[model samples]
Target: MYQVALIEDDIEIAELIKNKLNNIEFLSSIDIYEGPLTYLNSGKKAPIILLDILMPEMNGLNAIPILLEYDPDALIIMHTIKNNSETIFQSIRSGAVGYIDKQSSNIDYTKVFRSILNGGAYLTPNVAYKIVNYFQTKKNQFNSLTDRENQITDKIVEAKSYKDIADELNISINTVRMHIKNIYGKLQINSKYELIKLTKSR
Candidate 1:
């Protein structure tokens, strides 16, 4: 059973999220915290934290590390109306694996709980599209991308042959294929078309 901690200042929003969590059969308990101090005092080991960015006493972003200090193994999910690249990056860097916007698809309890239960990240479609666009704009900034992969990316832009790219990069055709696969994973593009569209936009 997963323990979910929801920390939202708005009484209505907190109750709504709490009810959603309660509806899920996997939740052993859904604890509500109006602020970080109360949550810290409660001393709960939360598997997933559904948090709002704006709150009184302490904002969600600032409170994340404190929450981690209370429970290092916590999987915090930023569930808020604020959706933007900077916030998304900060949330990711601050140890949040998921971000869901309240403005769009907030009522989708299935997607929300599925993300919590499967140990996978989930975002509202609007937020997901923004992330995809962000990836499109900055394809090469990936710390994981290799020089060979960049060469492939250039060829991908040029619409050159994979065999040629493999030979030029002095890697086996299969190795070149693997590099492209890794590049795609880092970029979060589904297909060559998306890669072309996204990369071209850069």
Candidate 2:
């Protein structure tokens, strides 16, 4: 049996989810908190936590690290109506083990809980598709870069100045600058910072 905590500001939705979770055989208890602050202040811990994205005090994305600090072993799941790719990836990067779309009608709470307890991660089908598509798009953008542009991108990511890259590659500074500009265009990014972030994400 496992205990669970649900942090949601909407009382009606919270009660509905609690009722549904109560029917899951493996769940030993379900506690509801109106928001992240309330949950944190309670000093309670659970094996699994269902967190809402939009709330008063602190949003779910910002609460992930704090919740993990409170209980590092807790499996936090984002239960939100927001399904944008940015928010999904941010939640995952912030340490959420699962992403469940609150508007998704096909999710089986019992199965979701069981999977997390068994050391597996879960995401709603649409959310999974969005993540897959994002990587695929990034891959295509990367493949579009010419070999020279690829080399310049590597140097830029390494924080090499245009003059340094030009000297190392035995090319003129003007050539290096042009290649970098082309790399940025191919990657659809504006600056070295964005380029570095894109490379690291890959």
lDDT of each: 0.80, 0.92
Tens-digit lDDT track of model 2 for 1-202: 9999999999999999999999998899999999988998998898899999999779999999999999999999999999999999999999999999999996899889988999999998989999999999998999998988888888888889989999999999999888888888888999889999999877
lDDT (10s digit) by residue, model 1, range 1-202? 7888888888887887788778878778888888877787886677788888888879899988888887888888888889988898788888887788887754676667776568787777888899898875675555457777777888888887888887777878898778888888988876778777766656
Best by lDDT: 2
Model 2 segments more than 4 A misplaced? 168-170
Question: Candidate 2, clashing residue pairs?
Answer: none
**Candidate 2 overall Cα lDDT vs. reference?**
0.92
Q: Against the correct fold, how does model 2 do in TM-score?
A: 0.91
Best by TM-score: 2
